[model samples]
Target: MRCEDGHDDAAYVLGALSPAERAAYERHLATCSFCREAVADLSRVPDMLDRLEADEFARWLDPDHAVEPERPRKPQGRVKTFSVRLLSTAASIVLILVLGGGVFAWWWMGQQAPAEPVFGPAVAMSSIESTSPIAATIQLAGSESGTKVRMQCEYSVTAEPYNFKLIAYGPDGEKEQLGSWLARPGAEFSMDGGTRFTQGALARFELVRLDNTKMLVLDVK
Candidate 1:
């Protein structure tokens, strides 16, 4: 069976699909790289949900209770099945929350967990130096899996039509090409990129032209 547009990934990760459908998708995942990657990415949702405290899960499951302890009692017998159903419903709700927004929401929620901080606070990059008449700033924020980058650029006509790329150097001396976009002359542009470097792992970020000329470099301190 072929994977159809990765729609089964969400349902499969949430265990919402029928057994037959799940089996078919598993077979498809064996041969389809796209569906395999989708399943791998969506599989993180359960791990994120696991980080929530038992009381937090209880509150999510039963928000009406005002004075609940951290460790809630386990459901017994038939109530266990009911609890499973409740958790399944909660998973559906979460899937709906992330369906349009993408898996980033799941990781973002984990990082913004209430009990404790999963990542350090946001850090702003140093001012950039460019040869052309361009103004840009890059901000790196911590996430559960890595660092998230937000880049904004205001370019003069001199820099128009240039293919620009963002590269990040991690603390371990690993380099990653985050993304690339075209910079239209006399226009402002903003793009979002991500790297697999954890907090404090990113050493520097470079904005380079397609011809391999360096435009700007921001060092993380």
Candidate 2:
């Protein structure tokens, strides 16, 4: 009993209409029961189309889809006209799903990937010598951006937490605050740091307490 005259349920379902067309169609829906029911029936189309992954969906949208050959055109009819509108809507849907899938894939990869590459090896920094009651080891690796540093440290003398900084001293009197962390007693912890100076330029690294006392010295030069 509702009007299906000029309203398109598929277009509404696939979000293919222009803004003005959409607003007009929505206004028409308020007075039409048939279009409303049709819209609800087609609402699941989008969810079905989204199952295609980015790569597969992009292949389907590629111009090579026409690589086979073209067929002779037939005379237009009412059914064909409606089908053409549906095909346009389907293209819009494919574009949206392809773009959405690509972005989702990119974001998912960034989440799963490491922020930086694995540094070389852990050097026994405790063997270097210490001026305080701390046990520590250092890892130094070269990177295009800078020198990457990793440390395993423990304040074995007490069970209290103490803040420490990885202070890097360079050959040209360059002092860089590479990184800092809180060292809890008894249990060992790992920390990370970086410096613009390469391993060769780095003269030494010091674990300095908050009051500027050097607890350990790791000579790289």
Candidate 3:
């Protein structure tokens, strides 16, 4: 049989396969390492289910009993009884290890999962001289690659052609020019821009004109 047919290992272990199909899969298992490993892995599922059923039965039989002593029996073959008990104990240990390892793996995967992005509260920009009509707010969102910036600005357009420059200053004096834009005169203008700096690494954000005159500055903490 083709290796693709090995996908029925779960059904085979659960006794869901027909007699003919089970015979064919056993023959295929002899030559297919993938199917063999799949069978070994899935075999524990039935053992776990069986353990659960046994626990339920025991609980139902004696709900109030804390510890029950084994009843003495007539001397059956000592060696045969010893061997059976040893094999049963070994099987129970293997099942516990398999089920415990699976639970630990699931917990570890959950712990390592990526968290949702958290955004910092938007901080409003304050003018240095107190007479500047330019208003702005800056916000930062944490991401896997880097922190994303969102800057919103409201400017009083008094000059003829509005030539604006948005700059982000890093904590270490590194400066990045975000972008530039133009707006019409005698009208209130708003602009949106972004930068690559993380929120904590940013020292300040500034909006200025082409002539190097600072229009607005936001001190970051």
Candidate 4:
């Protein structure tokens, strides 16, 4: 019903339509928007053909006419026509199913997956004195149910002056990265909001302070 499907209708009027589809299309084109557009697009074909044919005829009759007919380049075929049509239809079906499946899977996962905890350490963190000159302890707490496990580090800066980072390791051998904010000079400094946990029965969080030390561990059971 759109103006874009211009084809065969023009070819039909020019008697170039395949015998199998000509009558059916001509009858349909009498009132169809698609057919109308197709005919309109093809209208120029006849005029062009007529001009070339007439010029050729004239030149043939009189050497003085001397005009060469410009032969239009024929369109090249890629895949066979039937194969292209079949492929197009199959591709459409696949595209629809893929999009539909993705939407359905997303909704299903959202509904079935348990919510993640906000902040918590899966295990206990031990401060490293030998590794770095920094003396710090990391503690963590997280919501039991939400979207992800959050890690909170409550640590102090020693006289040696140090910076640290907290790292969390998931059970699947994937390490979830929380951030290391600088411990404020006066009071305990804490950082939260680590990674999103999606669709696993259980996950663990471990915090490693820069100076590469494990300060605290919280387990989301």
Candidate 5:
């Protein structure tokens, strides 16, 4: 039940372990962080199952396929049921928070979208002119110690009061989002985004607007 056991512990936690093996593994998990985290991740299943119909849960957690390769798709059925009832309720709460007394909440959401990138010669990013509200950059890929190439710049988009998207591109042209940020006239922001990559050459990171689609390249290394 060591972290090294990974999905192996997941199987054991699910009672998928053999009687003898389960007893041995249970002893091991008492002192294992990896097993503890795996169990927590799988614990989400009880609530998910409770939210699903009896038949749906039975079908989803089918014993023949106890080792599901991915998370189950969202539940689809009457919302009045305990399983699906909170789905829309949760979404409504998020929408309400984003509105949060803003007069233009509807308008802002209509024009907003996540960031997109065009690599190599196709990029046409405008220069950020504002020196305030410095942009944050993070290192997402590397060894467990998280060595990375990163950089920072200032926010200069006219799309006020909205966060920007952060994306990273490797030397070989792979792209991934680091996350998003709310723009302030003059402030500093930073975070550590988690991504896995084997040791390799350097990669590039960029910050782009959620609207207007502008981009600014940060430093590499």
Candidate 6:
């Protein structure tokens, strides 16, 4: 995604980075929560694409399935017209490249041992146990200075908004609030954080509501 800091994390997540670039980005990932979250957000895209077959994706270039153009309307001035086709061959090729070429690599991944995750080691997340209506998963990817935490939550019931904080407790009873958000119902909530405590050092993570209610808790696993 887009960051005001001009970080092109999309490119990073898409495997477009050179070796040196990848190393630098991983170093930056150790500290930048924005970039870390961007990585998590894009991590699933490749897996979704992994479901498409080469033959199926090739259908995008099938001329027979081309979308018929809408009725042409007279323009008042010298307006430009655009093609109505879903995708041209050249555009389709570029689309495949931008999708990280993972669709084509599906066969390769299965023929051998499992390959690396598209978004590196930080992509896989663990589930948080809770009896509440809220369900969520969390991941703690360690960094030299600390660990990058990613949380994905699903919530929906009413149109109301809920406010909450992600609290991290250190081994010695130290506490830290990673971040907070006003979550609106009918949507998923994603957040990122970095802490000095590695995954092993943290006692647990508590999703505490503004009213001092513990909505969810994730113990070390």
Which predicted model would earn the best lDDT?
1
TM-scores of the models, in the order given: 0.49, 0.46, 0.41, 0.32, 0.34, 0.42
True-structure Cα RMSD, model 2: 19.0
Poorly placed runs, candidate 1 (over 4 Å): 1-41, 44-130
lDDT of 3 at 126: 68
Please write out the lDDT profile of model 4 over residues 1-221, one tens digit for every residue: 13232445544655667776787776665434335534553454344333333444355336697675567857547654555455444433333244335653464467666454334334344443444332333334333332333333444445334465555554566654545555654445544442434325335555554666665444545
What value does the lDDT take at residue 91 in candidate 1?
58
- Per-residue CA lDDT of candidate 1, range 1-221, in tens? 23344777787877888988888887766444446655776677676664555456666656796864447677588987776666755755565456567465665567764343233333443434534655677766666556667788877886547788888887767887766778888988887656767647878888888897777777885
The residue pairs found clashing in candidate 2 are none
Candidate 1 Cα deviation (angstroms), residue 136: 1.1
Query: Can you rank all candidates by lDDT, best first?
Result: 1, 2, 3, 6, 5, 4
How does candidate 3 score on lDDT? 0.63
Total clashing residue pairs per candidate? 1, 0, 0, 21, 5, 0
Global lDDT of each model?
A: 0.67, 0.66, 0.63, 0.46, 0.48, 0.62
TM-score winner between candidates 3 and 4: 3
Which candidate, 5 or 6, would have the higher lDDT against the true structure? Answer: 6
Candidates ranked by TM-score, best first? 1, 2, 6, 3, 5, 4
User: What lDDT tens digits, residue by residue, belong to model 5 across residues 1-221?
Assistant: 12444556546644668988888777755544345545664554444434444444345335564534556768655653644545433433333334346533555446654233212222222346544334443433343323332334455454356578766565577665545667765545554343233225335556777874655665454
How far does residue 101 in candidate 2 sit from its true spot (Å)? 13
- In angstroms, the error of model 5 at 165 is 1.6
Relative to the true structure, candidate 3 reaches a TM of 0.41
Candidate 2 residues lying further than 4 Å off, grouped into runs, are 1-118, 126-131, 157-159
Candidate 5: where is the Cα deviation over 4 Å? Answer: 1-142, 145-159, 219-221
Per-residue error for 133 in candidate 2, Å, reads 2.4
Candidate 3, residue 105: lDDT: 44
